[model samples]
Target: MQGIELTLQDEAATIELGEDLALALKAGDCLALSGDLGAGKSTLARAFLRAMADDEALEVPSPTFTLVQTYDLRIPVSHFDLYRLADVSELDELGFDEALSDGICLVEWPENALAALPKSRLTATFSHLGDGRTVTIAGEAAALSRIERSLAIRAFLRERGYGHAKRRHLSGDASARAYERILVAGEPVRILMDSARHTPGPILQDGKYYQQLAHLAEDVIPFVAIDSDIRTKGFCAPEIYESDLDAGILLIEDLGSDGILDADGRPIAERYLESVRVLAHLHAQPVTRDISLGTITHHIPDFDRRAMKIETSLLLDWYLPWKRGEKASDTERTGYFAVWDQLIDLMASSEKKLLLRDFHSPNIIWRGERSGFERIGIIDFQDSMIGPTAYDVASITQDARVTIEPDLRDIMLSLYCAERNALGAFDETLFRRDWHLMSAQRNCKLVGIWVRLMQRDGKPFYMKHMPRTFSYLEVALQHEALAPLRDWCIKAGIL
Candidate 1:
């Protein structure tokens, strides 16, 4: 009863619904199909399977004869035809439990095995409607909620004339945002940015939520504003073709897949240098903090001491407890903040710029054929802030995700300094010092982030990067201004 009802006006609509479900369903999900023999259940199942395979021509035979058919897929699927099932005990022999444990299950004639189905399984009951079919998908709240969002996105795209475009799921980053590539015949591919407004977490410190204290974007407005502003400045931020700001949906240009990393995932020297040049070009000019969004004005936040200190504290709060199997002591915490306090004070008068908070490989799209600064496509700047120029420089040079060797790191830094020098009075010494300070600060935050992602978010894939992050931190601490921090790290055992 806790679900949504949809009308499939034609076969195409039925297939679309199946595709939508493919996007919403995950491992351990069971989609129980209920309908008369000719009421389109098999049609829906075939569409779901083909979409999951990302191959339109994928063979999807009915499971009625075999009783069950399984396909090894991105998320493996098991199709079950339970009409021949005589009793609940037979479900066990059919590997029902194994199917549910490993991947998604699409069970036809679910009524025959009602007693054996998962209590949380989604049931799509289809019935003939005039010349079409009507389905009411009912399920537990969690699965139904994801389906609702998918339906909402479909409606949004329909309203914007992209209803018929094929949707291919793209891997999302650490945020709750989702992305899909839109494929339409004879049209340039566009990306659908499905970023619902962020839900605030419980207050963590100083009567503010973690997102509030950290200066993270709470909605898509910042992204839209930054995208518009950056394009005006001749940068390669995606062009928004259509947007529903209230719904947090946008149809934007698809910056192609080429990146600064090579096929082997290592950083390419030339591409990395071009990315460094992007930051140089961006930092050399002054830009306004106020961005206009037609009816609204979005002001970029300053990367204040509060935000910076809170970030560095993540190393204490998450990483230390994870590594040492205990919380950091009060003295250890005090000493860590003492070093950061001095570093922040030293950069109080430093020149500020529009820092693309994540100016690294993952966010940079290499536009090999494009001319000028447009050669680099910059995505993921929603968290943009007015911060010290060295922050962005540090983000790319000592990229947390990529291992930049000392020689190449120095070359990239030198290139950035040379570019800035050509533009105006640039003191390499002060910039390099700030770079080291910012690098250490960012790596400290990342070291904690990797652990937090594993422990709090159940994403252990990030933990593998811990060694590289620690190495980057060690490199940054060699700076003389960071001597106090280095000594503290040694005492705390993180160094």
Candidate 2:
């Protein structure tokens, strides 16, 4: 592993460096703090610990007495003193093995356990340098490379006037996107979206990955284009601050954390009604197929039959087989397609409007201080397309991630329909018919998506929502229009 050496002039500089390291540190990482007693090993380690905990006054007492101190910070952390240890073998009794896998570790006098140290660890040796101290960091190649990338991000932030910003991880979502909040000294906190370039999968159809087939966004361009469109429409979408299109990085305004869901994790009817009104207003306007992106033209895609089928097919490919513990046969699969073809065709016949594919509680933020529809801060619409407006309404009212109680859902649907019908040109009858059909189609896709997320992607959290999704699907399946498909599901025992 290569080493990177830097000198910190004072205690503040030392703490700042530690905070920087804290950004890249994850669970299972080790910061072997090594140096003489007065060389500031504990100082650097304590600073790192405090930053991770987000509490400057956090007690980071030396582990000299206890030999190890564990803190339940955002990322659990362990501080160890090996000098007082009788034997390296005693580490097992101390649960060091489990601790390493559980959180970040900072070990002072790590040389005492040098023979037992994990090979994937980072070692920081501090030494006196004039009035300050020199900290040299060395680690496995992969770890060091990650450190370098963190350093690069720091530089990128500095150039954007966030040199002294306090970076906080906002974690990740189901997609490949990563987010961080950068709070500068006086400026409003900004969000840093780290969307890595998507690696295209094997060419299964017409040299495209599943994302391409589904018309899903592959990078940050769609977000930028969509954000501009939403802002131009006088909505509450976050403003883009600075962007690096090639690097897939965007520094944008931070939408406050006040979500529409209440303490019970259910949507507040008032806020959800406001969102429905927002959709009603949007659908009533003239639709724009084109988005102005400087020299680039961003054309919103149509939610075509191929994309619809590709999504619905996930049920056959993942959920059904997983439920039965057996793969679907050609005949069964063909029958599944036959049922979906009718539903897809019905949805295709509906009038086209801008469909924010993921319109739901999770993507909607409640801005109570704002006016009317602007109070609903919409995010995560990069996969939006020109399709049946009913699709978005169904997604919100059915809400795969959060349960929309049937009664509450009825109120929401009624409010949405009332608002939509107020525009004398809209057809309430046709809209109602399309809503049930689209709801069933969307929920059908979510069933397979949740299953695939668990079985193939190793993310089981979404699986918890499958029952709620299926419940919504059942409600829609009961519609007279979906009777054929409902019968098919019953025959397959997937109902």
Please name the candidate that would achieve the greatest TM-score relative to the true structure.
1
Give the clashing pairs for model 1. none
Q: Measured by C-alpha RMSD in angstroms, how accurate is candidate 2? A: 2.4
lDDT of each: 0.90, 0.84
Tell me the spans in candidate 1 whose CA falls farther than 4 Å from its real position.
none
- For candidate 2, the lDDT comes to 0.84
The ten-residue window of minimal lDDT in model 1 covers 167-176
The digit string of per-residue lDDT tens for model 2 on 36-149 reads 887888887888887787777988888897999999988888899898989999778877888888788888899999888898789989989888999899998878766775
**CA lDDT, candidate 1, residue 39:** 91
What TM-score goes with each of the models?
0.97, 0.92
Residue 403's C-alpha lDDT in candidate 2?
A: 82
